[model samples]
Structures are given as structure tokens and as C-alpha cells.
Target: MLLPPKDSVLRQASFTNFWISRILSSTSFQMLSVAIGWQMYALTHDAFSLGFVGLAQFIPMVLLTFVVGHAADRFDRRKIVCLCQLIEGGIAALLLVGNMAGWLGREQILLAAAILGACRAFEGPSSSALLPQLVPKHILQQAIAWSTSAGQTAQILGPSLGGLLYSLGASCVYGAATIALLTAGILTCFIRVERSERKTEPVSLRSVFLGLEFVYRHPAILGTISLDLFAVLLGGATALLPIFAQDILHTGPWGLGLMRTAPAVGALLMSLILAYYPLQRAVGLKLFAALAVFGLATMLFAISTNLVVSLVALLLTGASDVVSVVIRSSLVQLQTPDEMRGRVNAVNSLFIGTSNQLGEFESGVLAGFIGPVPAAFLGGLGTIAVAGLWMYLFPSLRRLRSLSES
Candidate 1:
């Protein structure tokens, strides 16, 4: 038997279209985030309000997960994704109008966040579940890695662009995001893939809970997902970044942009390396080790008062996170059956949304009480402890060797 040539994922037209669409959408999201975070902090000067942004987004996403997951599995995923992107673009347009009207305030931004979150609840599962249909199974890991690299590349550019546009005005930043999202939606329409056969089971409590049941039965999946949930939930430092940029490091919006870009810079470099030379052995142990480094980096970032030092720490955090992301994503994609991918990914998205958005809320609330520096320090400590405990608890996950073999 002969082996197929490497980088075959690049040859697929549907995957290429999907990849480009991802870049556009991810870039728009990053830009929108930068604008919202900066504007919210600037308006309220309250860390709690900044946290509310995450809370607003998190609530709708978690609330609608099951319904959206069912929709992804039941309907045409491409259309679902395309429609969601269009809705997101409309939200961006709303933000632009509000900003230009000179009446955009914290409440309006929070409402926009809630609306965006609702769209994303549907978008996440559809997009994730759609990927396996675009590429051959043998190249799925490569496809995932490359796709992530593209996203990281967007992160690298998005914040910097957002900051520059923001300098012109908040409306300018929103305008750019609107254009990107609309373009992404257009690109999404061009993607062509054969849909998987739909499940014919009648809708019921059992059908709705099928994804949860599948994940519950698999110890490795449960362990990995839960580990990320708690680790990032505690250790995420993004919410306090405005504080770090303004009060701690004494930097303006331009400096904040650089601070935000540091992690993606690190992740992008690591992703490029992984894309060519994928993780081939000791996948589980490597994940744990990378997570340990991530925790350490968070602590280092917490204590750093100097701008350059903080950037380095953030860079390390991003680099370490890339390893975890690639390994975990490959594991989830490989282990999941096609029919269950949507629902399973919906559950996975909830974990991610909790870790990211809810984590922001936690960081904000903690910062309001304890101060930003100590909040981050404590969170980092919690991350390290979680990693150690998870390693001991999930022995099967720890002993896992390869993505393909698993």
C-alpha cells in the first residue's frame, strides 16, 4: 500500500474556501472584541462592567447550545453557518450605527454581545461539524492544524488593525469589522461539501441528550474537556488586559493592541511548526506539560510590571496553548462519529465558552475585589493545581500516545 502525499488538505476546494472564510470571520471577531473591550473599559472605568461583556455573551451561548446543536445536526450546516455570519454582520452594522450616533453606551454594547453570542451558539457547532465533510480522514489532523494556524494569523493582524482603526474612531473599527464579516459570509457560500446522512431518530429528551451521553461514557474526552474548562476558567487573563494596558503598564490603545497580539504571535509561530511537523508521540503527556507551561506563563504575566516582560509571558502562554489546542482538537475530531459531531461539538463549545467568556467574568469579579494582579496570580495557581490533579485522575488520558492511534 502506498501512502498519500502530505499537505493534501490544501488541494481540496471546499476546505480552501472554508479556510479563507475562517480567516475573515476570526479577524472580524478579534477586531470587534478589541473595540468592545476598550470602549467598555473607557466608558465605565469599572472592571465589573468589563466582566459583564463576557457574561452577556456567555449566557445566551450556554442557554441555546442544545437547540443550536440539534439544528446543526438536522439542517444544512453550510446554510446554517452562512446565515449566522450574516446575522453577526448585521450586529456589527448595528454597533457601527450606534457608535456613529454618539449614543453608544455600555448597555447597547452588552446587548450586542448577547445577540452575537446567540449567533455564535449556532455558528460554532455548524462550522465544527462541517469540517470533517470537507477533507479526507487521513488529513483531518493536518486540516485542523492549518485551520488553526489561519485563525491565529487572523488574531495576529486583527487586533493591530482594530487598534489603528479605533484610533480614528470607534465607528471606524466597527465599520471594518462589518466589512470583514459580510465578506466572510460571502466566502462561506462558496464552500461545497457532501452532507452527512442525518439521524432519523425522533426528537426527544434522549436525542437532545445524546451528545452529553456520548461524552459521559468516554473517560478520555471527559477528562480532557473538563481539564480545559477549569484550567482556562481560572487562568484566563484577557479580561484584565485593559487594566494592565492602562494602569499597570501605562500604555494607550496602541500598546494594548500590541499586548493583545503577543499571544497570537507566539501561537502562530508554534502553529506553523506544528503544521509541518505534527505531534506524533506522547500526545497526552505533552498536553499536560504544555498546560503546565501555560499556567507558569500566566503567573509570570501576572507579576510583570514591565511591558516587554509581560509581552514575553503572554507569548509563552499563547505558544503553550497552541499545543494544547492542536492535540485536543485532533483528539475530539478523531474520536467523534460523524452523526454526533454537531452535538458533541456543541457540548465542547459550551466548555470553551465557559472557559473563555465565563472566565472573563470570573477574572473581572475577582479583580473588582482583589485587584487585577492578585486575581491573575491566584488564577494561575489554580491552573497549575488543576493540571496536576487532572493528570492523576485521568490515567487513561495521561497514557494516551497518538492522535491517529487513539
Candidate 2:
């Protein structure tokens, strides 16, 4: 009997390695985030301080996004990813040791978390670009969906696991993160990325301007990304979840875990559905409608005090957000030229990462001033208003009929 070609075996190995790395990396990242949030809350009890933690993480990524994007377009992605995973592994080890030694003070943990954010600044764009090299262009959408689903899966389990582990002891959270990172490191060793042609010319500030120019020039790409960014920035109620769990909902760490998992659970289900059927029609309209639903869901969650009701609202919020994400990702992928993909995706990441962290900041800041409940409810209302304004401003997006139109 004839056997599969050697190249086929290599490709399989590479793809398997990539996904395994994704799973482990995601698990560690989520668990670490949960641990950080819980620890910070325990230490400071102030919402603004939690918000500052997010600000610390966002600054480095925003500052370095373009440079990292340029490098992703220029370098061997596998090597870049390997180096990042190694750096992240060391950071996890440091956290583990500090916790074990009873030296993981709040100030030290905050500094370490900031360093972790700096490492992620380099990692995100490079990893985003590397996927296209591993899979065929035909399956790129599916690959993105699958990768997102893996992240959602990690988000679903990691927080609950972190809470359980934290109850055992703070060291347990770091210990689990260490194991996850080691697994990712081992998997990173097996990935093989093909080298592409690179321009011999040196990069400069002018070259970065070209990317900004392209993004501004593309109405569809610019509009979709902007809409999601604004919607999430205004509507994200996740920062207040801990307050809801502890005070309003009358639960503890476990409730926080459920709140974290609720959105991921909905997102994972929506991902599976989209994977099978895909979004082939009225993409932009769908995106607008989804964000509207997301805003409404957030509003409901903000008002509700019951744990089950809050979780249900979060589930719907996540489902709506997934629709927006898939549409925006497809737009970014299909609209860009091959060489410019990294820069555009970098720009895209800036918006996404900013929305998330800054949303946390907004929630925390507003919560401190107006109190958490009113702040959350008002934010959700603002998100809906933003969505309406965006729909009015971008007529082409509201009328968008198909993915191929991009």
C-alpha cells in the first residue's frame, strides 16, 4: 500500500503542534489573569487599582504593536513564537517561586504582571501572522474560528480551575500556570514555518505611516474594527463581575469563576454553530445586530442580581460578541494584501486589546465614582448608543450583503 508523503506528515505534525501550543498558552494566560484579579482585589479592594493593572498591560502592547507588526511581516514567525513562549515560561516560573516562597507581595506581583504584558506585546502579532503560514488560505477562516474556540475553551475552564486552586492556596494557581507554560514550550518545539521573501530595505517611521494610511483608506475594514472597539469599550461589564459575585450576587470566588465562564460557554457554542454553517450573507448587518444584542445583554446583566440571571445575560452577551468578532476577523483577513497583513492585523490588535483593557479601565473608573451597579448599567446604555451612531455613520456596513464584498 502507498503511504502519505513525508511533507504531509511534517505538515500534520506542525499543525498539531500549533494547536496544542494554543491550548496550553491559552490555559496559562487565563488562569494567570484570574489569579491576578483575585490577588489584586484581595490586596487593595479598590476598583481603580484593578483598573490601573489593566492600564499597565495595555500601554506596552500599544506602544510596541506597530513594531511587532513590522517584525512579524519580516521575520521567521516560528522562531519569534518560540522565543515568546520561552520568555512567558520564565515569567510563570518566577510567579510560582515568589508565591511558594511567601514573597509574592502585591507590588511585586503588579510589576511582574506588567513585565508579562510586555512579553505579550511581542507575542500577539507574530502569532496572528504565523497561522496563515501553517494552514491553506482556503481554510483560514475556519482556522481562525477554531483558534478562537480554543481560547474560549480555556476561558471557560481556567478561571474556575484557578478559583478552586486558589482556595487550596495562592501557590496552586502559579503552579498550574507553570505546568501549562511548560507544555506550551514543548509543543512550540515541533512547529515548522516556511521562510518567505523579505525586502532588504530598512524599516522606518514613514513605513509605519503607510500602514496607518492603508487602514484609513479602507472604509469597510476601518468601520468594522472601529465599531467593535467602541462597542466593547463601552459595554464590557467584566471588570465589575467580581463585585457582582461578592456583594450583589452573594457568592464568592466560585461565583466569579461562573461569571468568567458564562461568556466563554456562550461563545464556544456560537463558534461551533458558525463553524458548521459559516457567515456567508449579510455580514455587516449581522455584525451590527450582534453588537446591539451584546449591549442589551450587558444591560440586563448589569441590572440583575441573581446569579443564574446574571449568567444567562452573560451567555447572551458572549454569543452576540462572537458574531461581531467573526465578522471583523473575516474582514481583516480578506481585505488586506499578503505582505501588509501583519501591519493591518497589528492595527486590528491595537483596537481589540485597547478595547478590552480600556474597557476594564472605564468600568473600574466609573464604578469608583458612581458605584459599580449604576456604572455598569450606564456603560451598557452607552454601548447601545455608540452602535446606533456607528450604523448611521457607515451606511455601506449596514447594507453589506456578503463576505466577498470586502
lDDT of each: 0.86, 0.80
Per residue, candidate 2 scores C-alpha lDDT tens digits across 1-406 of: 0112533666667777887787788777777877888888887798887876776777888888888778777777677777777777788788888877777776877787787787777777677777767766555666667767777888877777887788987778888787777778778777886666755347888676555777888888889889988899989889899999999999998898788888999999887777666787777778888988898899899899798999999999998898888788777777776567677788888899989978988999999999988988888898889888988898888888876575
The C-alpha RMSD of each candidate to the native structure, in angstroms, is 3.6, 3.8
**Candidate 2 local accuracy as lDDT?**
0.80
Q: For model 1, what is the alpha-carbon lDDT of residue 155?
A: 82
The digit string of per-residue lDDT tens for model 1 on 1-406 reads: 0114563443466677888888888888878888998999999999999988877877888888888877777788899999988989999999999888888899999999888878878987889888878877776777777888888998888877888899999899888889889988998898888756766677898888788988888878888889899989999999899999999999888778788889989999888788778888898899899889999999999999999999999999899988888877777788988778888889998888778867888999999999999999999899999999999999988998988654
Name the 10 consecutive residues with the lowest summed lDDT in model 1.
Answer: 1-10
Q: Largest lDDT belongs to which candidate?
A: 1
Model 1 deviation from the true structure expressed as Cα RMSD, one decimal place: 3.6
TM-score of 2: 0.86
